[model samples]
Structures are given as structure tokens and as C-alpha cells.
Target chain A: MVETDMNSQAKADRKAGETVLVADDIKRHYEIPQGAFGKPRILKAVDGASFTLQRGQTLAVVGESGCGKSTLARVVTMIEPASGGSLRIGKTDVVNASRSQLAALRSKVQIVFQNPYGSLNPRQKIGAALEEPLLVNTNLSKKQREAKARAMMAEVGLRPEHYDRYPHMFSGGQRQRIAIARALMLDPSILVLDEPTSALDVSIQAQVLNLLRDIQKRYNLAYLFISHDLSVVRYIADEVMVMYLGHPVEQGSRDAIFASPQHPYTKALLSATPVADPEGKRERIVLTGELPSPIAPPPGCTFHPRCPMAADICKRLVPPVQRVCGTTSWCHRPWEAETESAA
Target chain B: MSLLEFTNLSVEFETLNGGFRAVDNVSLTVDPGEVVAIVGESGSGKSVSMLAVMGLLPWTAKVTADRLTFQGRDMLSMRPKEKRKIIGKDISMIFQEPTTSLNPCFTVGYQIIETLKKHTDLSRAERKNRAIELLRLVGIPAPERRVTAFPHQLSGGMNQRVMIAMAIACDPKLLIADEPTTALDVTIQAQILELLIKIKEENDMGLVLITHDMGVVAETADRVIVQYAGQQVEQQDVKGLFRDPHHPYTAALLAALPERATGDQLPSIPGVVPGQFDRPAGCLFSPRCSFVFDRCHKEQPTQAGKELGCALCHTPLVAGKPQNEAA
Candidate 1:
């Protein structure tokens, strides 16, 4: 019976190249009111970001803190509506969708937070936590929900006996496993993983990464992987989008971005990340100064104050999007231009 | 003489279930102008051993050591007042969380001045100037204005800079930074690490860096010590330890890095670290070790010679293979 279920699920898998999510000029802004006498100020958290995700592929969004990566995740999962632009998920126009339509769309996209210890309810048992989604979303009976939750637990490497245990009884790694299991219970097509392994040990991180990859392959799921660790992004991301202060500075294939980073910020980010190899000798380009305040970002380019090769034009005007060697960059003087001139 | 010498240090905490050894037989030495790193996962007791050195552990912790000295001065037998004089003056520490480590109620300048008042004879005017100078040395822009700002007013990186300024306010001879940059971003981490190394060199201070990041270890450390389950498993120079780790746990941990992976599947070590109750009688890592033998499950292993990284294993690995298996 289990073998037939596996065969049927394999047959039911979606086409590998189908586009599951598309975002165009997505923006999430917050307006802070400064007392009733003063004017309201608009803070652009995520501004003019666009990307597409296909089945069985991972598109990682990499940035430092307060860069709006988490805000982007919230917008994509329909937890909050975007302030502007369009988002289309599997032919459903999410921006203009009705309430009933949104209720159905929410289940199609699921998110796993960074900290497992906080995300789970302490008083709730593992079985109830897994079944809560099915109960609220579907009309499945108690017996059916229990069967499905147990299957998911087994799939995520939890034992049958662990079904009755509380979350505090589990270790960090096991808690993360349970979190992943809970996210997968809805059979979502898109998964937004926000620093899923940042709080875990290296050994446990490897295990979770392997499990994510396996689940992605098995279900042909689209993954919007978000992380600040560039090494983990380099390993898991098929395409990488580098964001700085609410702007997409660079976007390209993983190999292209890692090998020949055109944007100054991207180069600095790659260099700042310390490689584990002691023998590998590479020039380090440490960017000076912290991220500028997003509320009142730099006049022109958000990264001009920290760019190593910033020209006078960079400080006066925003750089237009330019494509070079299969990578898109927002920079006035990309390294490729200098290299090409030298050549 | 070494700047700091710690021999056979152990810390056992009294819990409801009796005694739990958090640090077992850990020995470390630091000469001036050297950086030694203690690398381990959480609960590996890397921070506890350093806390024990500073006499900062709680009263419930039972600390025992054969010899704990600093620059030929005995630290273990010193009175509380004498130890206090040396701890914050000659030996300072920077904690992992910069925001929480600082007092939120006071201005950053006041915090730095407080440190100076305790350890230096400078007058009020001179101490204020010194505080601004220290902040400038740590690369904080407009130090004059930043000194007046409270801890909650500055960013995380800025607060960390303030913390560094306070830690180095007295010109300490030895600095113990416990995961100082773990709470920071990569770009900020780079800035903080560069600032730390610069300060260490300028002061000629011995530095002890406790972290779980192998990348940071490779970039900064002169010597590396790998700890597991409160025990020191291997000790070697930074290059040698990364290139050819002699302990199975160390090898597996290096393999687990995402940057070191060659394929999709990382060669992860199986199972979790042993707790107090579930700790094995023999090798603490035997349950998760790949090359475990029958003897490993029965008897504890002793430390090997220096060539083998002083690995705590009966069959220490050499170039990824067991050395005693061939014999």
C-alpha cells in the first residue's frame, strides 16, 4: 500500500520547469506618523524587487540585517499585502485576489522561521502542531489528519513515539526537524526558508540542508531561500539576488555571481565572508561603515557611500540596470568595465 | 614567561541530578603577541573555561586547576581584592552579545570612564579625553559625539565598537574575546575582527578567541583547539589543523562546512552531543563516530603526541585514516 502511494505521488508531481511564483516591482513600505502635528514619514522597507521562481529550483535572497529580506518573505507568503506592484502565484493574481482566493493561496506558500525554539508552541504536543494546519485548511477527519501527520513525522525523520512528546523535550536539531515537518504538512508548492539553519550547529546544518534538498526534489517544490551567510547561499542557491538597503544590487546565476561579481557591493560581500580554507589566498575588500538608515537612504545610490570604486556620478544619480556576462548589476563603474578597458 | 598559563582546568556544576562536568582537563597557554582560538559547538564549555579564568563563574560551579597563572603571578590562590585588580586591568574580556554586555542606563562615555576610574589614576577631564580617544581608535566616526550617545541609540556594530573601546580602555596585556563577532553581520564582523587584530598587535597583547566559526578561525587564529563534550579533542596550529585534522570529530566538523562540500550531501556527523545523564562510559563521541571500534565503547582514550595534534583518541587519524589500524 505504501509503495502504491509513493508511485501515485510520483505520478502526480508537477512539471519541473513550471513557473510557480513571479514578482514584479514589489514594494513594502511603512508610514510612521510623527505625532498628530507633524507630517507622516514613509519608510521603504523593500523597494522595487523582482524575481521569478520555478519548480524544483532555489532562488536565494542574500543581504545583511534590516535589508528587508524578511519583509519580502512575508509579502511572498501573503501574510501581509505589498504596498505596490504585482505578484502572481500559479496564475492567481495575488495583489488583486479576493478574500476567498487569498485564503486558498495562503496554503500554497509556507514559511519556516529561523528560530525553531520560538516558532513552536511550548504547551502543544508534536501531533497537534502538525495536525493544526490540516484541520484549519482542510476538512479532513481526525483519523485522516492523524494518519497524515504521522506520515509527515516519519518522512521528516521523526519516530512514531515522538508524536506525543512536547517541544521542550527535543534538542535544537530535532526541533528544527519538527518545524520543517509542520511546514510540509500542508503540501505547499512554494517554501520560504528564512535562515532555516542559522541557529543550528554545523553538523546539524548539513543534515537540514540535505533534507531540504531531498524534499525539494521529491515534491518538485520551489524554494525562496533567504540567508545572510554567503557560503550557505553559494551551496544551496541556483540563482542569487544580492540586496542592499532595500535594493537589488545584483542578480545572476550562482556560478556567475560567485565567480565574477560585477557590483562593488557583491564583491565586497563575497570578500568579507571568510572562507574556511586556510591555503586559499584572495584579496579582501572590507567595506567601511554600516548599512545606512532605510528611512532616509542615500540620495542617489544606496551603496555609494561604501562602494570602493564609486565615481562622482554614483553619488549624484542612481545607476541604471546594466547586464554584463550573464549578470545584472546596478553600478556606475562595474569592475568589468575597468577590466575590459585594461584588456 | 607566558602571558597566561592554565593547566588541567576543570569546572563541575552542581545540578539537581548531582554533578555535571562542564569543562574537563583543559590546558591552554598564551604568549604575548599570539592569538589562540577555542573552537566548539554550543555547550562545549569553551566559554566556561575562560569565565573560570576571570573568576566570573557562579558560586555553584566547582573549579579545580593544577596551576592558573598570569605573567608568573599565581591567580588561583589570590584574594578577591588582588584578583580584582588584575582581572579588569591587565586581563579584560569582551562578551559575545555587545548590546546586553553594556549597561543600557548609562552613556557609552560614562561606561568607558567607569572602567578607567576603576583601573587608572587619571582625573575626570583626562578620563573623558581618553574615552574619546579609545572610541576613535576603534574606528567609530565622530567619537566626540558618539561618546555621549546611550547604548540603545547606536547600531549593533557601533555598540560593539563601544564595547571594544571599553575592553581596551586600560591597555590590557591579555584579552579574552568570547565569540565577539557572532552576533554581527559579515561586513560588520570583518570590521570588528580587523579592529581586534589591530588592537592586539598595537598593544602586543595575547588574545584568546572563543568561537565555533571555522572560517574566522582560519582567518585569524595562530593556534586552534577543538573541544567536544567539554573535553579538548585536538590542538594544532591553524594551518595544520585545517589541512589534516587528527581527530574524527574534528575531521567530520571540517567536512560539514558548506564551503568545503563537494556534492549536494554534506558528510554530517550523526547524532547529537552527549548530555550529563546519557554520556557514554568510554569515548564520549563513540556513539556518533564513524570509525568506532569495540575497544572504543569500553575504555576512554588518552591524548596522543604532538605530531598527532595531541588528539584524544585511541586510534588517531592520519590523513583521514586510522593510524593504529595498520599496526
Candidate 2:
């Protein structure tokens, strides 16, 4: 079974820079019932997010809470179907995928959640937990499953003695490693990491991030990294998608996004993130007013209410996508000065 | 006189596995209008020390200090009645997890007013008016309607603002904010931090910021205390600490930050923090320290001189090199 799996993986690796996942204006909406008499109000958790994730690269979705980064993760991983738009995982269309196609897609795409404590079952031993995925998905024998699980444990830096230990016995970082090992049980091509290190300490987070980078290189896996942490995003992400109130306000390469943010929202977000260097010159654009309720989000470009450079037109009309310095920003007045671009 | 001071403070909690020393020997002093940040990972006892000062710890915990004073008044030996008078009135605290810290049974206004009623001699009308003003001061829009709103009605940021307002109701001389922005979004965190600083400046209050984020410590703290497994690993001014960390643990922690990474892989510290049972016999950080030696594993080191950022290491780092190592 392992040999067959390797052959299939080698066959799939024929093309370099293969696009593993392509999300075209994927959206997820939740309708809240307003009593028996009133109409149901629509909550646009994820409005229109479009991006393509390549093999052996990371595309990070960054936003504050309620900005639908998690919702987008669910959509991409096919855990929750998008209310609109399309998602293609290598050639399989997610919108109309049959049972067998979905089963195949599930093995190809796996997710590691934020809270390792809640994600794992306390009663389940590490070995059994890792093998359960194989038990359900593949026809491998029990011994073969145990061998694969043990190999994965070693790959993730877990000790051989820790195989029979319960989840409760392991620390947070160790549990997260277990979670990552479980996600890789089927040798997924695309991994969805939704705030994977947010719950961890800085030191532990570093270890996990290094592990992720190592695993990504070894497996040549494409990663859909979802997080609100810009610093972490700046480190791991090849491309960045900045979301605001379920809208992709800015989308560009990591350098372009970090060095020269075109959108005002992106600029505010960058400035708001406190730099580790105290001597670093930072022009803080402290945005006033909290995020507007997504249920009754302001008309036009939902960010107009809090935008420092907001004009009359900005409040009345949604801004069209403007491309500048290899970055796309949905704003009426994007910083287009060529001098601001990074060398 | 210093706004707050702690000399050789220690906190031990009575757990199932005997006495667990949550906070080791920690010495700190905070002047009025100073921001002192206690930075460490979870189980590092950054919060416990501050909680010891606030007298908020459970009865099972034993708190000891050679000198624990607030404005020259010894807090360690103060009577319960006297301590209560000074706690909410002079030295207030904003707890972590605003959602859980706030009482769901009462309105935000009622809560703020309750604090005022306990600390001040204000009338009912004046208390209500003060509550609204406090809400408005914290950047909560439509303060009039928000005062009547319950904790559930407000967002996490707004609830945090309310918590701040409650803490500063009586204009505390020393404010202890324990992981205030941990539960908040970055934008909201920025706002809350700005608000705290603004409040601290206006009131000339000594602020004790207990958090783990290096970015936050760099941006906000005047002085920083780096804790590792209940021990004061290092203490220095924010700028110097970031520029030249004198402790290996401090250096490793700062290097572990993603923003500070020079390459693809971050220089991470190996192994988790020593828990109650698995604690090392000598140095608490020795097992994980990159420059660990046989001496470090055998004998616990005392705090180094001020030149070394008061690092609790025998071979304190000087310009990233161990000072006591033989060539």
C-alpha cells in the first residue's frame, strides 16, 4: 500500500509549481432566523475570496476575528461547502464532486486546527489516533497501519515511547505535533493550517513553524495558512491575502504586501502590528471605530466608515480593483508612488 | 517614593504534587508613570506575582516577600480591611479574559458604579454620570446606551474597554493589566494598549503589563522582566533587553520571534517549560538552554550584576558570549 501511494505521489509530481488548489470567489454565508414573522438576516462570513495555492508554497489568509479567514479555510478544505463561487482541488471540482471524488479529495487535503487540546480525543492513544485515519480511508492491515503511524511519529519529532501515551500526557507543543502527524497520515498534497501556532508560546511556535517548513519541503506540500498574526504570516507566507469584513481588500506577494501595502486597511494593519524592534521607525495609523457588524456592514466598501483617507465617493460606491507594484487592492485611492516599492 | 516595589518576592501554590513554586525570587520597582512588563510563556508565573500583589490569589497559595510595598506602605503585613481599601482605590487590576472576568448578571454600568460605590463616596446620580463619562473616555461610542448593556451584548474589545474603565474608576496609582490584549484582535489590541498608555500617562499611574508577546513588550514597556519557569531570568530596560539580551533564555526567546528571523528556519529553544514534577534540580531553564553546561545542570545560579541585565545565570551572556567561560 505504501509503495502504491509513493508511485501515485511520484506520478502527481510530474510538473513543478503545480497549482494544488484554486479558489474562485469562494463565499460562505450564514442566515440567522429573525423570529417567525421577520425575514432571515444574511451574515456574509466569507464574501468573495479568490486565490490559487501552489505545491511547496504557502498562501496565508490574514484578517482579524469575524473577517472569515477560518470560514475560508473550511471552504478550501471542503469541510463546509461554500455558499457561492467555485473551488478546484487539482482537477476535481468541489461544487459538484461525487462521493468517490470527495473521498479522494479528503485524502489529498487535510486540516490542522488552532486548539490542539480540543482537536484530539483525550482517551485515544497517539498510535491509535494516528492510525484511525488509515483504518477508515485505506485497506492497509493493522501492522502496516502501526508501522506507518510510527514512521510519521518519528518524522514529526515524537519519541517512540510516546506512541502508546494518551493525548492528556503530552504538552501543548507535543499535542500539536501529533495533530500535524495525523494530518500527514494519508500524505496530503494540500494542508490547511488555521491559526496553528496562535495558541502556542513564542519558543514553541518557532519549533512548530520549523517543523512545518521541514515537512513542507520533504513532502512538497502546498499550504493554505490562515492566521491573524502578520508577523508569522510575514515569515512563512509566499503570498498574502488580507481580508476585511469578509472582503479581500488586498492580495499580493509577501514582499509587496509587507514592504509597500497599497490599501489603507493593509497599511493600518501593518502599522498596528507592533514591531519587535523598539528603535524601528513606525508611523502608527491607529484606525478609529471597531469593525462594523457584518450583519449590517456599511454600504460601499465596507471599510469606508473607518478609513482615514475616506472620500465622499468611497462612502457611496465600492472601489474597483487597482493594481500597483504587483499588488491588487480594492480601494479608491491606493498608494501608487513607485518610490515606495521595495528594492 | 516608588509607586510599587517588590523585593525578593515569591509565590508558592499548594497543588496535589506538594508545594509548587509558581514565582521564584523576583525583585522589581516601579516609579509613577512607568510601564513595567512581565513577559513569559504560560506557567511562567508572570501573572501569579502580580496576583500576589493584588491579594487576589486563593488562600491555598502562600505569598512571601522581604518588601512588598505600594507608596511606602507595606502590603505584605497590611490588615484585610486596610488592604481592601487600598486594593480597588489605589492599586487596581484589569484581569485577562474580559468575557469571563466581567459579571454576566449585572449591567456594565452597575459594575462600574459598584466599584465607584466601594471606593468613593459618590452619590447614586454622580456614580451613574461618572460611569458614562468613564465609558466615553475609554472610546466606547454611545456611552449612554452602552452603560445599560450587559456583558454579552458588547464585543470583546468593548468589554475590555469596560474592564479598563472599571479598573480605573477610582484612578488607581498603580494599574496591573494581566494579559489584557491576549484575547483581543491585533487592531483591537492596538486600541486597548493605546488606551491603557493614554490612561497611564493622564493619571501618572505605574502600569504593570503582564504578557508574553515580544512585540507588545517592545512597543509598550519601559522596563521588562523575562521570567522562565517561575524564575526572573532577566530584567532590563525594553530597548537594551531587545538589543542585547544578557540571558540565554531571553536571547533564545527573542530569536524565536518570527519577525526577528533572518532565514527560513527560526532559532527555537528545544523542550517545553519544566512543569511542577519534572523541574530540574539546578537551573529551571538549563534543560532547554542552548549554552547549557555541566555546572548549569548541577548548581543553581544566582542573579548576575546590573551590567548583565540581572540575568539569573552563572555564565551570563556579554555580547552574546558567555562571560564566565574559560578560553
Q: Quick one: best TM-score, which candidate?
A: 1
What lDDT is obtained when candidate 1 is compared to the true structure? Answer: 0.93
Candidate 1's DockQ: 0.83
Candidate 2, B196-223: lDDT as tens digits: 9999999899999999999999999999
RMSD of 2: 2.1
lDDT of 1 by residue, B1-327 (tens): 999998999999999999999999999999999999999988899999999999999999999999999999999889999999999899999998989999999999999999999999999999999999999999999999999999999989999899889999999999999999988899999999999999899889999999999999999999999999999999999999999999999999999999999987888888898988899989998999999998889999999999999999989999999988643
Clashing pairs in 1: none
DockQ of 2: 0.88
How many angstroms is residue A120 displaced in model 2 relative to the true structure, after the best TM-score fit? Answer: 1.1
Error of 2 at B46 (Å): 0.6
Each model's lDDT:
0.93, 0.92
State the lDDT of candidate 1 residue by residue for A1-343, as single tens digits: 6634864685486889799999999999999999999899999999999999999999999999999999999999998899999999998999999999999989989999999999999999999999999999999789888998998998888999999999999988899999999999888899999999999988889889988998998888899999999999988999999999888999999999999999999999999999887888989999999898898999778898998888789889989998987899988888898799889
Off by over 4 Å in 1: A1-13
Query: Could you tell me which residue pairs clash in candidate 2?
Result: none
Interface RMSD of 1: 0.7
